[model samples]
Target: MSDFRDVVILLPGITGSVLANAAGKEVWAPSAGAAWRAITSFGSSITGLELAGDDADDGVSAPRLVADVTLVPGLVKIDGYSRIENYLVEHLGLERGANYFPFPYDWRRDNRVSARRLESQAMAWLKTWRERSGNAEARLVLIGHSMGGLVARYFIECLGGWQATRALLTLGTPHRGSLNAVGFLENGMKKGIGPFGLDLSPLLRSLTSVYQLLPIYPCIGTGAGELQRIAAAAEAGLLTHVDAARAHAARAFHQEIQDAQARNARDEAYARNGPTLVPVVGIEQPTVQSVQVKDGRIELLNSHDGSDFGGDGTVPRVSGTPIEMGDAKREVYAAEMHGALQNADGTLANLRGVLTRDRIDFRKFQRAEDAAMLTLDVDDVVLPGDPVAVRVRASEGNPRISVTLTLVATGEAFDEPLARDPEPGWQQGIFDLEPGIWRVTAHAEGATPVSDLVVVAAP
Candidate 1:
C-alpha cells in the first residue's frame, strides 16, 4: 500500500450508523429482512431504541452503552459505506482499522454528543498515526455523508478539530437543514407503501437531531413569499410533534457551528491553516423544496423539476450550501440521489481530489449546463417482491435515454432498457428486484446520467 500517512476517518449521516440494545440485539441497521419487520410492527420490533427525553439539549445525554445509549452506540451505518471504504483503501492506499475507519455513534441523539465523541477519538488517532508513520505532516481527512457531515463540521468548528484536520469533505449533507426532516417530524416517519408502514411519530418526535434537521430556511408558511420561523410554526400550533424549545435548540446547533467557524477564522493560528471545507452537492433530482402549513399539519412541497431548489432529492441546494461556505477550495455538483451520493462516481472522484490534490478536470462535473436535467421516476423506498416501475423524463424534449438497475450489495448491473411512453418526454421500464437496495440510473444521450436509490424492504 502507498505510504500515504494521512489519517482518514469517515462519518456517516443520521441512520447511517448501526445501534444495538442492552440485550446486545442489533436494532438499527439496513436489512431487507428487518426492513419489512420494522415496517409492519416498527413500533414494537424496535424497542429500547428510543431516547429518554425530548430535550436532549436540555442536558448532556450521557446514556451508557446499551443502558441509556445516549452516547455513540453504532457503526458506519451498514455495508453501503463499503463502496466508499473500498475506494479510499484502493485510491488513497490506506488500510482499514489502521489509518481508515468510520466513526460509529448512536444516530438517535444529540449531534453535539457525536461531535464531542468525534473530537476525542479523532485527535487521539491523529496523534498516534503521526508518530507511527513518522509523518508530522499527517493530518485528519474527514469524509462525512449526509448528517454525518454536520457532525464532522461540529467537531472541526465547534470543538477545535481544525488544528489537526487536513480537509473536511461532505457529500449530499443538508448544511442548513432538510424540509424532509420537517415532514418527518411533523407527520412522523411513513413508508407510504400501502398499509405496511410505521407510525414512528412518537419515537421520532422526541429526537433532538430529528428536530435539528428541520428546514432553517423559510419553510412553514403559505406557498407565497411570506414565511415564519420554525419556532413560530411551533407557537402557532403548526407543528404537532416538535416543541418550541427543541425547535429553537436545533436551529441553535447550526448557528453554533457557524459562530465557531467565524471565531476560528479570526484566530490567527486557525485562520492561516484551517481545514479545507469542501461540500459536494448533489443535483438534478426531485426534492422537497419547501412546505406549507395546511390546517393543523405541515405539508412538504417537491417541485420535481430538479431545480437548484430541487436539491439531491432530500436536501435542497439552499440547505446543502453552507451559509458560511465562503469560496471553498473545492466545490462540485453531482447528478445523484441523496442516499447514493456516498458511492457516486463524482463523489469518489472529488474525494480523491481532496485527499491527494490530484488535478481533476472539473469541466466533466459541470457538464450539467449542456446535459438534460433527468428525473428518475422511482420511490426511495420500495416493497419486497414488488415490481419497481422505473421511468425517466428529461427537461429537454423526447431525448434518447437508457435505464439500468445495479444491485448495491454486489456492484452487479441489471440493465432494463426502456420503451417510449405514451406521454411525451418520458421513457419507462419495470423490473422485479429482490429485497435489497438498488441504484436506478438513467442516462441521456450525450448528457450526464442521473441516478436514485430504491430500497426493496424485506418480509
Candidate 2:
C-alpha cells in the first residue's frame, strides 16, 4: 500500500513567498523585525531592498524577465499560507513533504515562465505517487492562490499539465486583470501619514508581474470617457512617463496566454479528459474597479462607485472566477476580503466540501452583458455618523455613466454626477444616511440599466 495516496500542492499569492540571503538578510517576506524597520525608515529605506531574483537584466528584456532564479519549496514561510499548510497536515491528516507541498516562486516574474517551474514540481510529485502505489496513472491536486492560479492554468492548458494533474482549485486568482496593479503603476503608493511615506512608483514598475495584472478587458476608461481595451489605452498614450518596454513585454505575455486559453477552450479532448478545475470566488468586497490620472498622478477608484461589485478586495469576482470555467466546478462566498482567503474559515470549509465529493457541478456560465449588472460596492452595515461611500459601476457600454441612489426605505433618492478624469469614470457620493435598504442604479446613454441593493445595518 502506498503511504501517500494523493499529493496536494499549495501555491501562494503575490508577495506571499519569503526570500532570504546567506547573510540573514530577508526581502519581501513579512516579519516582526521588518515591520519595526518599516516604521522607523522613510519610504522603503528599510523594506525596499531588492534581491537578485527581482533583477530584470537577465536578458529577459522589458516585459518578460528571464527566469534565472530557482525557488526552494521548503525554504518558504508566508504567514497566511503557513497557517493553511499547517491545517492540511494537522487537521486534514495529510502528511507533510509526502502528500503535501507548498510551492514558492519569484512572484515578480512572468506567470507563463513560472508555470514551467510548476510543471517540474508537479511531475516530480506524480512520479513519487506512482512509485509508492505501483500505479503509473496517479495524478496530483493543485491549490493555487492569486497569481499562482494563473501559473497553474498555464501549466494545464499550454504545457499539457492536465496529463499529470487531477484537479485545480484557485482562490482569488485574477483571470482577467486587477485595476490595483494599474493604480500602483500610476499613482504609486499614497504617501501615508508615517515615517515611511515614499514614492512606490519606481518599485512597482520594476516588477514584470505587476504589468501582467493589468486589465485585459475593456473595463478601464480613457480620459475622453470612452471604455477602451488596455492595449489600446497604452497605445493611445493613456499612461505617460511609464515603462513602455515593460508594458509591451507584459502585453505580449498576456496575449500569448489568452491565445492558449482560447485554444484550450476549443479543444474537445482537453475539456473531456483534463483535470477537474474548481474556482472559488469571493464577492461583496470593495475592489478597485478603475484607475485614472488625477492631479498629475494615478488615482485608483472603486467600481460601481464602491458598490459590492463582487471581489475579495484585490480581485473582482467577475475577473477572479473566469467565464471560461463556467462549466467547471464553482464555489461562491461573500464577505471574504483578499490576502487572507487562504486561511479563512469559509475557504477551508469549501476546500473540504469540494474534495469530499467525487463529481463536479458542471454548471454552464454565460458572459454577463455590459449593462446587465450593477453593483453597490459598499459595506452592508455602518454607524450612525459614519460617512458611507456610495459608488456605482456598469458592466459595459460607456465610461461616462451616471448613477442614482435611492434609500428605498426612506423614499429618498439623488442622482450623482460622474467624477472628473484621474478619478474613475463612475460617480461617487458619500452620505450619512439612516440605516435601511438602499438601491443603487447605473445608467449610460446607450446602455441598459443595472442596479444593486445595499443594506445600511445598525452599528
Best by TM-score: 1
Residues 149-242, candidate 2, lDDT per residue (tens digit)? 8888788878888767778898888887788787677656544433434445565666778888887766545455656655566666766644
Summed over model 1, clashes come to 5
Q: Report lDDT (Cα) of residue 356, candidate 1.
A: 77
**What's the CA RMSD for each of the models?**
23.0, 22.0
lDDT of 1 by residue, 229-253 (tens): 7888788687766688888888899
lDDT of 1 at 70: 24
> Model 2, residue 173: displacement in angstroms?
0.4
**TM-score for all models, in order of appearance:** 0.70, 0.66
Best by lDDT: 1
* Reference-based lDDT, each prediction: 0.75, 0.66
Candidate 2 regions with alpha-carbon error over 4 angstroms = 1-4, 22-24, 38-79, 190-199, 222-225, 265-268, 292-297, 304-308, 326-331, 359-459
